[model samples]
Target: MITGASSGIGRVAAMQLAERGWDVAVVGRNPGRTRDVAAAVSGTAFVADYNSLAEVRALATALLERYPRIDVLANNAGGLVGRRGRSVDGHEQTLQHNHLAPFLLTNLLLPRLVASDARVVNTASLANRGGTIRLDNLDGTGRAYLGGFPAYCNAKLATVLFTRELAKRSPVTAYSFHPGFVSTSFGHNSAFVRWGLSLLASRQISAEQGAQPLVQLASVDSLGAASGTYFDGLYPNGATARRAQDDNLAAQLWDTTARLVGLTDG
Candidate 1:
């Protein structure tokens, strides 16, 4: 299952996976492009705007109904929205959409994932290198607007931290990777972001190239036991920071996230 599969790295990865005869599920916010991707890949398509928790829950239920076993849950639907905004769920836009929404969706589907002994590939980024996250107050508005790419970095950092946290308790394998600065519509909402990305076009790779690690992480038989690892593209990279390695912080973040998403039974 690939969220953000409507375009860029997600779409290319889905196509490649389909060509390899793997069952693919294309998910995205755009109805037209998602449908196109599903048709092109001959896979099922699910549409859920990440801006709404209700939609995320519904999407999870739909996926559970259609797919008895989800071998992979790629948390790939996220981007840096330039200006500060709130999601339909009332959380900050980038934090909620990029981090919290996926957090909720994955938990909602955790049972299916565990039943299948799934591999979860979180599309993380180097944006996390210098991020400052308020793990105690994950839904706090302050962290949501962590300034510029800091917001994105914090969310990406959370992605990595979540992987580490999940692996500690779940048998499911988890991996997070930086899909090398692939040229995508990630920050198309902001001209400033586009301009900044263009400056790095010399170092940027294609979306297909960026998707390689996700494909490998998903399909590699050798990595079936590989959990709580971060990759610099396809190769193993060091942790984002010492803070990301903080088990206490990770646990707190998980608890906070659970509470935010209404998972109170824990």
Candidate 2:
């Protein structure tokens, strides 16, 4: 199952996996495009807007009902912004969509994931270098945002932390990987970030290239033995920042996230 499979890296990755005879399920926020992608890959389509936590729950229930066993759950649906916003659940939009939404969905599908011994892949970012992880401010409710870059970084950092936490708490393998600066609609919502991303066009990678690590992490037999490791490309040699190295912080974030999402026994 791949979230954000309607376009970009998710689309490419789903198509590639489908070609390998995997029964891919494409999850997207856009119905038409999602159906288009699913049709292209001969896979199923699921639509859910991560901006609403209720929709995330609905998505979880639907996935569970349809797929009795999910072999791979890729939490690839995310975005960046130049401004701070809130979701239907009233949390910081970036935090909610990029981190919280996937977090909740994973927990909801835990029983199925464990039963199948699934691999959970997260599309993280190198921008997580200076990202902050504050136990007192998980949603950035009390902080001020100069721009969305910091918020995006924080969310990505949270993704890596959550990967580690999940690996420790569950039997399934979980990994967070940075796809480099892939040229996509990731920051199209912000004129400033869009222009900034355009300036780096010379350095950005294609969506197919960006999806390579995800494909490797999802299907490669070697990676099956590894869990909670962060990958930048073909290898797990890349490193995260100081804050991301905190086990205590990961534990706190996991507990806080469980409480926020109303999970009974997180």
Candidate 3:
């Protein structure tokens, strides 16, 4: 199952996996585009907007009902919100959309994931290098809130931390990766983000190129690395921000996240 599969790397990856004879589930926010992608790939379509935790919960329930054994789950449906805002669930929008929403969905489906021995691929970014995960301030507001890309960076860092904690606590394998800056409409809402990416235009890669890492990680039989490893493309890279490497921080973040999202049993 791939969220954000209506466009960009997610769309390309969904197509590629379908061609490889995998039954892809294209999850997207836009109904029309999602249906188109699903039709193109001969896959299923599930719609959910990550801004709302209610929607994320519904998506999980739907997914659990549809797929008996999910092989791969790509939590790829997030972007850089231009300004500091609150989601319907009352989190910093970036924190909710990029981290909390996926966190909730994945945990909700944890039983199935463990049973199927599924691999989880989180599409994080090199911007994670700029992130600092403060368990006290995930909302990206007040003194800690540096809006725009910093918020995105922090959320991506949370993604990596989530992956690590998940592996530590579960039987399923989980991986997070930097997909190399890809040209996509991901940050179209943020003019600053667009300008920043434009400055690096020469270094940008295509969506297809970016999707290769996700494809490889999802399809490969053996990664030859631990479940919590983060990758730069297909290669394992341990050079994350200091906070991202902190197992104590990761565990704290996991517990905090569970409480924030109302996951009492976690």
Candidate 4:
């Protein structure tokens, strides 16, 4: 299953995976766009707003009921909300959309994933280097102000830690990756960031280029053994940093996230 599969890196990944004979489930917020994408790949499309937990739960239930044997789950449905926004559940939008939604959906779908010995790929970012995991500030409400970049980094960092902890408890192999700042509509909602990113166009790669590593990781047999690792592009040679490797911290973050998302037992 690929979230955010309607455009950008997600779209590229979906197309490549389809060409390689993988039957994909494309999940996106826009029904029309997702239908277009799914039609292009001969796959199915699911529409759900990740910013809302109720919507995510309903989508998860539908997906589980429809596809009983999922071989791979790409948690790629995440982005920065333009301003400091709140979700329908009163949680920070970035935290809800990027981290908690994926976490809940992955946990809910673990049975299918493990039954197929699935490989899970999470789309983290290099911006995570600047993130600090503060259990007290998990919701970003305690902070005086929240910016798009910082909130995004924090959420992606949470993804890495969550993947690591999940690998520890479950039989599923998981990984998080940095796609190398691709040219996408990622920052389109923020004019300032868009302008700044445009200035760095020479350093950025195309969405297809960025999706290559994720596709390789998802489809390669060798990567099945390398669980709970962080990747820069296609390389998975090193750990994410001492703090990110802390299993205890990861557990704490997981608990906090569960509470925030109202998934007490997840």
Candidate 5:
């Protein structure tokens, strides 16, 4: 299953997986676009708004009920909503859409994923290096912040923490990835960022290029040996921050996230 699979890197990855004879589940908010993308790959399309936890939960239930097992879960449905905003649940929009939604869905689907030896891949980012996780201010309230990218980075950092902690708790392998600076719609909301990225044409790669490593990570047997590792591009080996690998921090993040998302191990 791949979230944000209607376009960009997720879409490319979905096509690649389908070509390899995997039954792909493409997820996105736009039904028409998702259906078109799914048709191109002969995969199923699911539409769900990540901004709504209720919708996310409903989608997860439907997916688990419909599919016997999910061999892979790619939590790639995330973004920065430009200015500061709040979800229907009263949490920051980015935190809710980018982190909390995926967090909840992954946990709800864990049993099915585990039953299938599923590998989970989270689309993390280089932006993570610029931000810090404020446990006390998980909602990004009570603080004057910059624009979108910093908050986006914080969400990605949280993803890595979540992946690491999840790896510790289960036999299922989980990894975070920096898909490189690909030219995608992800930065289109910011004119300056978009222009800058455009200027760096030589540096930015296509979504197909970015998706290569993600597909390799999900399908390759060698990656099975390393759980909770961060991948840069297609290389299984890369330098992740020491803080990202902190078990103590990862555990704290797990507990806090579980509470925030209302998922206790009952």
Candidate 6:
């Protein structure tokens, strides 16, 4: 099951996996595009806006009803917000969309994933190197959010922390990855970021090239590495951010996020 499958790495990864004979569940915010991708891949399509926790819950319920066993869940639906906006759920938009929403959906489907022994692949970023995890100020209630790019970086740092924490607490394997700097419509909300992406075309990789790590992690039969390992492309990364490597911080973030999403039993 792949979120954000209507475009970019998720879309290409869905197609690639379908070509490999895997049944892909193509999920996205756009109904028409998501359905089109699903049709192309001969797979299922689900629509959900991560800005709404209710929508995230509905997506989880629908997914559980549709698939008996979800082999791989790619938490790939997220992007940068132009400002410190708020979701319908009353949290920071970037944090909610990128981290909280996926956190909720994954936990909601935890039972089925554990039963199926599924692997979870979170799409983090190299920008995580610039991020800091503040359990006390995760929502960026004040001037802490900085802006779109900084918030995006912090949210991605949360992604890695969540993956490691999940691996420790759950039976299923979990991994996070940096997909390089992919050329996509990822920073549509931030003009500065978009300009940066365009100006640095030499640093950007194709969506297909970026999807390789996700496809590789999702398609492997036996991932011999540790469950919570972070990947830099196809290989394990030794230089994860210091904050992301903090086990205590990861646990605290997991517990705090669980509460924020209204999950009582984390």
Overall local distance difference test of candidate 5: 0.85
Q: What's the true lDDT of residue 221 in model 5?
A: 78
Candidate 2 lDDT, 5-39, residue by residue in tens: 99999999999999999999999999999999999
Q: Using TM-score as the measure, name the better of candidate 3 and candidate 4.
A: 3
Model 1: worst 10 consecutive residues (lDDT sum): 139-148
Model 1, 189-244: lDDT tens per residue?
A: 77677887889989988898999998998888885345899898878865586678
lDDT by candidate, in order shown: 0.86, 0.89, 0.91, 0.86, 0.85, 0.91
Best by TM-score: 3
**lDDT-superior candidate, 2 or 6:** 6
**Candidate 3: stretches off by over 4 Å:** 144-147
What TM-score does each of the candidates earn?
0.94, 0.95, 0.97, 0.95, 0.94, 0.96
- lDDT-sorted candidate list, best first: 6, 3, 2, 4, 1, 5
Better of 1 and 3 by TM-score: 3
Q: For residues 34-143, what per-residue lDDT tens digits would candidate 5 score against the true structure? A: 99999999988899998788999999998998799888899999977777788887889888888899999999999999999989999887777765787778887866
C-alpha positional error of residue 227 in candidate 3 after TM-score superposition, expressed in Å: 0.6
Q: What lDDT tens digits, residue by residue, belong to model 3 across residues 1-266?
A: 99999999999999999999999999999999999999999999999999899999999999999999999999999988887788888888888888999999999999999999999999898888899887888875675443388899899999999999999999999999999889888778888788888899999999999999999999999988899999998798756888888999999999999999999754
lDDT agreement of model 4 with the native: 0.86
lDDT at 51 for candidate 2?
92
lDDT of 6 by residue, 176-209 (tens): 9998889888888777787778888888899999
* Decoy 4 TM-score against native: 0.95
* Clash pairs for candidate 5: none
TM-score of 3: 0.97
Better of 1 and 5 by lDDT: 1
Per-prediction tally of clashes: 0, 0, 0, 0, 0, 0
